[model samples]
Target chain A: MLREDVTEAIRAAVFEELAAVGFARMSIEGIARRAGVGKTAVYRRWKSKLSLVLDLLTAFAVEGLPAPATGSLYGDVRALLEVAAHALRHPVASQVIPDLLVEAARHPEITEAVRATLLDSQRGVVAQVVRDAVERGELARGADADRALDLVVGPLYWRLVVVRDARLPEGYLDDLAHASVAALRA
Target chain B: MLREDVTEAIRAAVFEELAAVGFARMSIEGIARRAGVGKTAVYRRWKSKLSLVLDLLTAFAVEGLPAPATGSLYGDVRALLEVAAHALRHPVASQVIPDLLVEAARHPEITEAVRATLLDSQRGVVAQVVRDAVERGELARGADADRALDLVVGPLYWRLVVVRDARLPEGYLDDLAHASVAALRA
Candidate 1:
């Protein structure tokens, strides 16, 4: 539908603007201008800036980052985090995504959508990899895949988001992947 | 000094308001009104609302809960997470501290203060306990104390901040603590 395309265009523009200006300073007028649409057109698509930004974030935050199937569970796990860390360093992922995540805590609907779109999807990938590992007798039957996934992803996020480091250092992902796999073995 | 007293009052008032309204809606004027001081008092002390909030957050967030000195490594780990988890569940801790954490990500000064006050403090506790465990041969000397600590704390914070789950169920702390220790040992 033309309307759907217009909505996508406006959301794409909003995501770009959010990357540039952040959540607090992102303006509806600016998004409309960038999308080549009127203010009313933008307003008709989203009820509020929060909803608009939420939709944009949902689309852009988690899409296109699929976990690798590297045959070896360890390789697959490391590849997953390596790709995710690199993606998070992308301009949009780096700059505005954190702002949206922090703000989402305050807005319940946005928080839920981001969780479904961003966290769980990534988590689901990790779970499948772990399931494969379990089937292959690499990981124990009782091993909590989600917890194992957290072991790999959590520290990077802790360092990046909580500790606010510039980037993960060389071999950090590999170290985490190896250690986490060893930790979860039968 | 009279200036110091006023600063303290403004900081305390800001803390109360943050617990009450959160960072998005919190205002210098509201802090002043709550503190029974003029807006100028807050302005004279801090450059921006972020600065003011960060200062207050740094001061108030360094809560040192008790850690049991149980001889067993598992018991000590269990006790530590239990204490941290319960502290997080405390009404004030849940409502007030997360906003500071979110704000800390946006501001460098705040992030450093948080590292010093909250993260480092927790790390110290974990390190001390892990050292005990290593000395007792409960954990292998090669165990990465820091990563093990992160394993325990990360899931709790992820649930609290990301999932926004108010109730941390019974035995959750024990499960995480045991799993973290086991993960490291494995």
Candidate 2:
């Protein structure tokens, strides 16, 4: 309980700092200020902003790529996308992840870590869904699972980061889920 | 030829400025300074940075939306994604469009123009492709054209902005193209 609480407190500080100044401008000092923690304590846990923010992102959004066994491909994908959209809609997750990703383009270590974490986490969700669909005969036998996953989840990322507008409407999610099912089934 | 050359030069300079400093940090004065032109000269042609940058982005990449008449859905989509990839690979086009879109989120005028010029232009392209597909019975008569187009181009935008990677492999393009076809035909 002590470890869990401490981890959450640090993460809360990281999220607050990110929301206030963004990931690029956020610092351990600022996080400490916001969290009311000593700088040494914050550094003792994360060592750097990237490391702290990365863990926060992992804990907040990328923690589990849950694959719901909804008994149908469309339902399962819909569940995944809806949950993803909800999780990403958080002020901290949305602000920090995109900024960190933009920053990652310039910083190789950050880029590698972000890429590895996202791809690994996403791939796991996609593989399970695809495998389930294949076994259920809902997906084509030879359909490429990873590519299908990318197609399924890629649009949500685009709408959030590139479009940077209103949240994904229910219609948008439904369309994505339907199209994903169609693609894999084809 | 003279008019085209001048326009190209102006667009190139605007694009370069965008890449150097993001949309918020970039200004007409900065663009003028970078382009070696008077601010009055820029204002005389385009009303604002939003217009100038949007015009350049549309000119550079919007054409990719108009899919070729490739008889088969596969060929048509393959050609479409290829053109989209080409747009991203173009330095000025790739760097500037994302900056403008992100800027549009906070600016009303830019958002309006993005919807009218950039988004509308590509939507038309996708619509035409879907029409052709429907005519050929490649899609169901009741297939939702707008949703289909979103799915088709969504992955490309996702990889570019969300991934924020410097380079995306041709394999990604291939995978998206194939997956879109599979989805459509399913």
Candidate 3:
């Protein structure tokens, strides 16, 4: 396989392993075997299992997030929620994300890396959206952007992942967007 | 030890085990050893490892949740958030709850038990609170209780557990309650 194809294969294998067995039990050999690559090939690119996982998680975080700039704050917030819902609904993500959260809580290094790569970046995107709304006078100048961002993203997450609700109601995203806008305005 | 004391010791040991090693690795032998009881004694009260964990979890769920019925919907919602915040902040709960979520994702029985004992029960409480609001004319007759409950509880759970934020802003719950009320009204 070409270098890029090999890299993609390895990344896919890592996610599969993580989703199936979780971070605690995942091993380099298993990832390599699943990817059809030599163990040395795995070691050649990443120094440790933690580094390998971190690299994959960082890449996923970047690829998964797309900052929306739809004119209205509600539009932008809804767009972001759509992206998040799509990612969270993925089978691999549904399993791996929760497991990673447990791992992150146990390991300070993973927690800090997750905060920087995933949470901070996501927070930054929401902050920019809030800033745009403030500039457009769609939101108050001193509105709590941080709290607004949490409200915008939190409900869908709680339903999809925490409650493990099988199906979201029709127009759920629209309701969430409207409610989030109401919260921010308040 | 007295029967009650023995039971309490085993319960404490289970939480400690769950917090330290997580559900996948926790064992009856380890729990017995930690509690200073025989393995047979541990098995006498619980049929299986899963049952033991479930019993502990159910007990925790029942003890942790206390539905509030304050006169106003806002007051009741704020009261619920405070109760949730207290549970999420507990050292054992902060660790065990996240780990259990991962385990629940992997185990059907755990998932169902959690749904019945915890999520459904909490949702019921929120539903009753919303019902009371509608009766009191504090909310519209046809407000979406489920969505309102998610809006009310999601942000606090996301911040304290998922993001693991060290400190919530002062008056955070109040803001959440007010925003949730606005969302329902809108």
- Return the top candidate by lDDT: 3
Give the top-scoring candidate (TM-score): 3
Tell how far residue B115 is off in model 1, in angstroms: 2.0
**Model 2 lDDT per residue over A1-186, tens place:** 376676677788777776666654577888877776778878778878887866665554456657788988898888888876775576643555555554554565766666655666766777888888888988777667656656777767656644555555657778777777766564
Q: Is the docking of candidate 1 incorrect, acceptable, medium or high quality?
A: acceptable
lDDT of 3 by residue, A1-186 (tens): 998888889999998888777787789999999999999988889988889888877776675355699999889988988887886798545777667777776777788666665477778888888889999999888776678767887787788887888589998888888888888787
Model 1, span B1-186: residue lDDT tens: 387787777877876777666666778889999988988877877877888766665665576644567998788878887777776676445655555555554555766766676677777788778788889988888666567665667667666654556675566676666666665665
Please estimate how well model 2 matches the true structure, expressed as its whole-model Cα lDDT.
0.68
lDDT of 2 by residue, B1-186 (tens): 365565666677887776766665668999877776778878878998877876765565445444588887778887877876676556544545544444454565666655654456666777778888889998888776556656777777656655555476547666677778877665
Candidate 2 clashes between residue pairs 3 or more apart in a chain or in different chains: none
Q: Cα deviation of A141 in candidate 3 (Å)?
A: 0.8
After superposing candidate 2, which stretches have Cα over 4 Å from the reference?
A: A1-21, A24-52, A58-62, A92-95, A137-143, A159-172, B1-11, B24-67, B92-95, B116-118, B160-175
Judged by DockQ relative to the true structure, which candidate is superior, 1 or 2?
Answer: 2
- Which of the predicted structures, 1 or 2, would earn the higher TM-score when compared with the native? 1
- Model 3: how far residue B158 lies from native, Å: 0.7
Interface RMSD of each: 3.3, 3.0, 1.3
Place model 2 in a CAPRI quality band: acceptable
By summed lDDT, the worst window of 10 consecutive residues in model 3 chain B runs over B58-67
